[model samples]
Target: MCGIAGYIDYTGKAGDTELKKMTDALSYRGPDASGQEVFSLNNATLGLGHRRLSIIDLSPLGKQPMFTPDRSLSIIFNGEIYNYREIREELSAKGHAFISGSDTEVILHAYQQWGDECVKKFTGMFAFAIFDEEKQELFLSRDRAGVKPLYYYQHNGCFLFASELKAFFTYPGFEKAIDPQAFRLYVQYTFVPAPYTIFKHTWKLEPGCSMRVDLKSGNIAQQRYWDVLDYYGQPKQKIGDAEAKEALRQRLIKACEYRMVSDVPVGMFLSGGYDSSLVTALLQSGRSEKIKTFTIGFTDAKYNEAQHAAKVAAHLGTDHHELYCSFDDAKAIIPELPECYDEPFADSSAIPTMLVSRFARKQVTVALSADGGDELFAGYERHAALLGIAAKKDKIPAALRPLAATVLRNTPKTVLNKIFSGNTSADNLAKYLDFLQGKTDLADMIDFANQTAAPDTLAGLFTQAASPGVLFRKNEIRKLPGRLDQLLAFDYLSYLPGDILTKVDRATMHISLEGREPLLDHSLIEWIATLPDEMKYRNGVSKYLLRQIVHDYLPREIMERPKMGFSIPLVNWFRSDLRPLFDEHLSEKSLAAHGLLDHKQVAKLLHEYYSGDNYRFTLLWTLLMFQLWYKKWMQ
Candidate 1:
């Protein structure tokens, strides 16, 4: 619910002036108040800036860059600590005194009480920086699931950290060069995974991790404090279906109730999908007052879910609001993409997410989202696909597998598209077929499932292309027991934070609305991870266990609909409303000016896309996003 920016300057050039500019850029994230302070260290000048969104405490006492009573430690934080009251009680029992009800104050005391291990006690989404005045050290930590963003830069004896990349632009002597490997990663995954950003000498502090900077010696070290893998690797809980459902129901209620601990008005985004509906149902069941719910409807029926959301809202008797938008409304948001997402993010669904957040912000200051459900439970179609591929690939005749792969590789994309009937793109089919050519293992299945672009194809597009390490962490991932469990663990590690969580954070914070993910409570995920695989997904149904609990609150007919994920009509838009933007940003002149991508290859790709190669839409969109981001930040 805030924006934090700070730097450790050995050269002594950065101070309140630089801090103000950096924080000023993040005003939309926290417009209630702003704070900036400079601490003179033994060998460096530490500057911290904050933009307050005032979710937990609306009083002046909640203002940050808050300091300890003795002024030995000061901190700037950018998230909510849902369990602060519980932690406060624990700290108070330890003789720690508190003057304010703000979670920021609780964090300061928690750090004092437990030192580096304090993060282990927190149960919330947070990205914070604490400067130990006496120790002359800066400590930074991000929440376990990375629900909040924290980007940092380190080079030439200087260290800078911020909630958003835009703040880094305000720092003096900061370089803007793109990291070649990260660019390739973005091209391959349509998102650059953490521990890597688009720029060199900078990184997103990986989730469940913390860093300590030694101001005196200018040394920095990072360590992982928590990981979901440990839970996944544990033996399955020897619990029955009824017991598991009851246990999950209790945890779900607690998680939802915890997120309702804000001073400001709160609401939920009810997408009519299993995840959102379940969150809305659980929260509304516990309250006498109707919870405010918001949903975005598309005029295009194929992509619309507002009607279903209205049904869920009515069933729960909550206040409901829906915005039905046209292609024009969605297209208008295209130009703002670069500003909404500081990084080059290619999730087309982000457009609708931002629209919904903007809509919800009109009446509520905080909104609860059900994002981590898909990763925590087996809710994704790809999860089923991974399991299905592993179980069925061996059924194919060993001698004819190569022949089938050859036929698929040589088939015309248009023909393949017709055969698949647009259920999936020919590009993905091609990748699957290629995987079939080899001896399919769990690792190979995962690699194929995640392949966005083949390495050879990416090499042809960029002048300097190298594979990112995240793409092939297959060996480590295969250690998990079940195929579904392994895929879920991999996603929770990479895709959950890299794409889904990032989209929600930026889209919500862009308008100063605090977006909370209730489904991502670490304790809930850890317990769910120990359940048997069939309990999560069974008989061709995903989120089977979660659905059973949801059924207890609502009828089966109302909640048994297909999962139509939040998405946009990107291909049709490119053919009509977005054609001009595609031309303007991906123009040969623009590509030549960027001097990173091969203009000739881009031209060829565009030719193919316009010539009915619709599978290439994702690649084209990724390139367009990168081009737009480059113009906005790098130019």
Candidate 2:
């Protein structure tokens, strides 16, 4: 629950002044305290800076740049190691003495005892940097589920790492060149995928990864310390449904309780969906203290779930808070999106996410968010629909599939739209055709499911081809025994981290709140990955097992409902309230100045969107977001 910034400056230039500036950029992430330390090396200078929110240890003793007993290893941490007490006991038995009741101390000592292997023994959300004084190297690790963010820039013998990309803006002589490949992917995926930032030479450390940078040789080596594939690759567990349900219940209970490890008051972001309801039910079942629950309701009824959440809160008898946000509340947050994310992010739901975080921050410092449930347990409707699509694709004769796709492809857009009731776009049709023609892969299907634009549309819009950053990692996915497993695996790697986790981390940290993903406790997902696919999605029910467990605590009517995701009315707003922003950001002057997008193509899209085309809202928002970010950070 903090912000950390550090660098190995081989040129011996940057020191306390630069480090302080870097840390200052993230001051909101840790408003409670701040610290900066610089160490002179053989021919370089290494510095570590921290902004602390004081979640676990509220005392000054928990201040970071914390060191081991011998001071051989210094560390700056950005998340909670939920199992710190257990690890502390283990370390104490191994003759380690701790001076503070902070997970930061436990991490430093753990690294001292286990070297790079320390990440394997921990269970929590974390992105940390440990400066090994003796080795003259920096060891960096991100949590397995990617709940916390860690970004780094490396080139020309200097290595810079931080908890957020904003910190890099303060470093001396740091280049701000954009990566065109990443931009095209951003246009295609609506968020830059990991290992690739919006900037050249900068990258988000992949989840389940640890990197070591050697000061003397300036050699950087990164290794995957953990991966979902390890679990997905295993044979499906043959356990019965009864045993599986009980096992899952026990795991869910443990995961939710573990996230309650905090000195500060904690709450739940209860959306009243299956995921959040289950977390609330499990955590509030035995607790004497009522858990504070927060929900953001839209004034628009179609998007509002506050009433459902209120029912759950009433049923559970927990303290609940709800805010009904108008268009003004959401629209006011748009101008700040570029700064909040610090990247060209296009998740419009971020507005409400930020609102909830701000509302909850008044009463709690730590809030448990149920984010990984969909990816881990087949909760999304698309998961079931895509499996259906695959089944239908399998049933159609492979030879006739190509003919069918050809006939559909040859049809005029207007006729196709008429046939599909104006709900299908050319991009959607292209992807569906690819699937029928056997040209679509798992990643492409995922892109179709989550895309803001179609492949053909993006190709026409961008000057460069989108890079298949992580989407092309199909060898392992192809080996999965079921389409559902493949879809889940690809999502865990791409969408979960690239969009979902990124959205939560940035939105929460922007408001200085520690958002914990209890459902994403790596162990829970690992176990879920082992169970048969049917256990998760069966008989047209998504999250079958999860629904069963939730039903035990909540009545069927209260918990079973269509998943209304955290969303804004972008369709109407883009035409009315947000039209000015779209015009301002996508003006000809702005597009011509950037020279990365086709002005004519953008104009065509804009014209269609303004002329009663609501489906283009996703792509339009993507463009507007990129333009906003480009003007802020690049220009």
Candidate 3:
């Protein structure tokens, strides 16, 4: 893992001094060594900078901003190419000579052998930019799932790209104005989705995509090399339950083994969830020595899973470590979230994620994570909810459906919360019907399920001039066959990369530790995509096949339980220990100075939450994060 930053200056202002500042901004991502190269290409000059973490070849030969033997192409890359050794052999047979035992060399040769299509052959997380000296062109590509981050800004005939958004602030003529639509999106979704950053001048490069910039014309064009939708739409392959499960077991083992190939010591974050437990089991089984496992515990038992993680680690006979964080530990993290996420990210779980990363970095340089398992195998309860809504919503009489909706809407949320008791299935009739109210189709169901704030409610919080943060557009993804399949694809497209993957990338990168996701192997994702939703989820059970594989290693009693997702005690924390923090960052005075939100409306939400409107905790968190981010960046 490394950090990469570069720019294309048509007027020739980019130089080594400017590149050094931009690269050093990402030192937290890589602290071992740094390099920069600036080249004049006719009318334009190109600059590339890299901060090396040295996970693969711990030698000076592995230094980046590396060049081809003939010096025609230069490259700076961030991420591990797990299949680099295999590809290196192929490139060697093709008479591609290399001076370094680094994946950077393999990528350079592959680009020479495959041209712009080189990214198609890579099978790991990556975001890289290649500067072609002869063509005076810059080519950039991000991995298939966007596990690595890349952002760029283009305006006034200048183009700049970086591993983190902060690097762009080092550019000479950069501005820090917030994008209104993106701010609205952040308010609505608690996160601004891809291709949209907090700043109007910058954009995230979409995953599985590449862009080519022509220095001569200042023209840029983008192309998608791979997409999840293409694989989701393929005809389902025929396979039986036992065969499929066994195949998945072997494939996952191989994927885990591949991710374990690093010069540095590696470990896993054993969350004790189905995904993490399996990763730990497979990893320990393949290695002779015990692997390190990390977990974070919270004071609140309902939100803590460290005890379970301890059990999993003890059973697997691995080196286990756990850190129990107090309310103060989380509070200390809030002040840093603005600069850590580099954007307004409202995921409360990021607090624990960062704590865990900081803990693991003390022992290991590379840590394997179990993300993408949910998106790949229909693990979220919402997937089952989407299916249940279709099957159960029609059972309500059409004429009485409006009456039921009215009744459910009229009932106090406190009463509804009592009845559901936090369970989210058929037994939660009041909440289910409330969610189903006015829902016409699967799209409506999805929107209702995903809403952090109602479109109407969010519209009221902003001025009329602000465009509604469009969380998703109609044509963003093609319709899939099954409701679960469509939801999974939608998440893999938007929520997976935008929220989950982004959260992990930022959290792991924050502490300068490399995070690898074994389950995100594209081949495993494609094979799992061929299975029917029934195999993935059924009878109110989520990740059905995953449970079976984990059961082979763990007791069903330990692994099977209501999924307590990684979350914080938001309502209690805000009302008690964090009340002063809320006052400091989200006070009326702060909101007024920010000028993005209506001060009165923001105050009203806070007042209501204090008045026992418990559901407002989420919205309040979002508002607080935005205000905090504004204070950090806009101030």
**How good is model 2 by TM-score?**
0.97
Cα RMSD (Å) between model 2 and the true structure? 2.0
TM-score of each: 0.96, 0.97, 0.95
Pairs that collide, model 1: none
> What TM-score should be assigned to candidate 1?
0.96
Candidate 1's residue-wise lDDT over 414-522, tens digit each?
8765644333454566556766777446666565555465555667888874656545346677888678878888888878899999999999999999999999999
Residues 1-635, candidate 2: write the lDDT tens digits.
99999988888779889999999999999999999999998978998999999898799999888977777888999999989999999999999988899999999889888989999999998999988888888889999989889999987667899988889998876898888898888887789988889999999999999999888788889999998988988888999999999999999999988999889899999999999999999999988899999999988889999999999999998999999999889988988999998999998899999999999999998899889889988887778667766776778898799887888888888877664443566667877788889787755686578777776677888776555645526677888877887899988988899999999998898888999988899889889999998898888888889998999999998887778989988888778767788888788888987789998898899999999877788888899999888888888
Give the whole-model CA lDDT for all candidates, comma-separated: 0.87, 0.88, 0.84
Off by over 4 Å in 3: 397-440, 468-478
Q: lDDT tens digits, residues 1-635, model 3?
A: 99999888876777888889999989989999999998877887789999999999999999988989889988999999999999999999989888888999899889989999889889899999998888878999999988999999998667899999899888895677788888888777778888899997899999889999998888899998987777777788788778888999999998999899999989899899999999999888856799999999987999999999999998889999999998878888988998888889999899999999999999999999999889888888777756766775668777788787777666776765564344332223433665567544565556555657666567778863665533444244436776776787778877888888889888988888999999999988888888877678878778888888999988877887667798778788788878887777777688778577787887888898888777677888998888887778777
RMSD of 1: 2.1
Stretch of 10 with least lDDT, candidate 1: 418-427
The predicted structure with the larger lDDT, 1 or 3, is 1
Query: Comparing candidate 2 with candidate 3, which one achieves the higher TM-score?
Result: 2
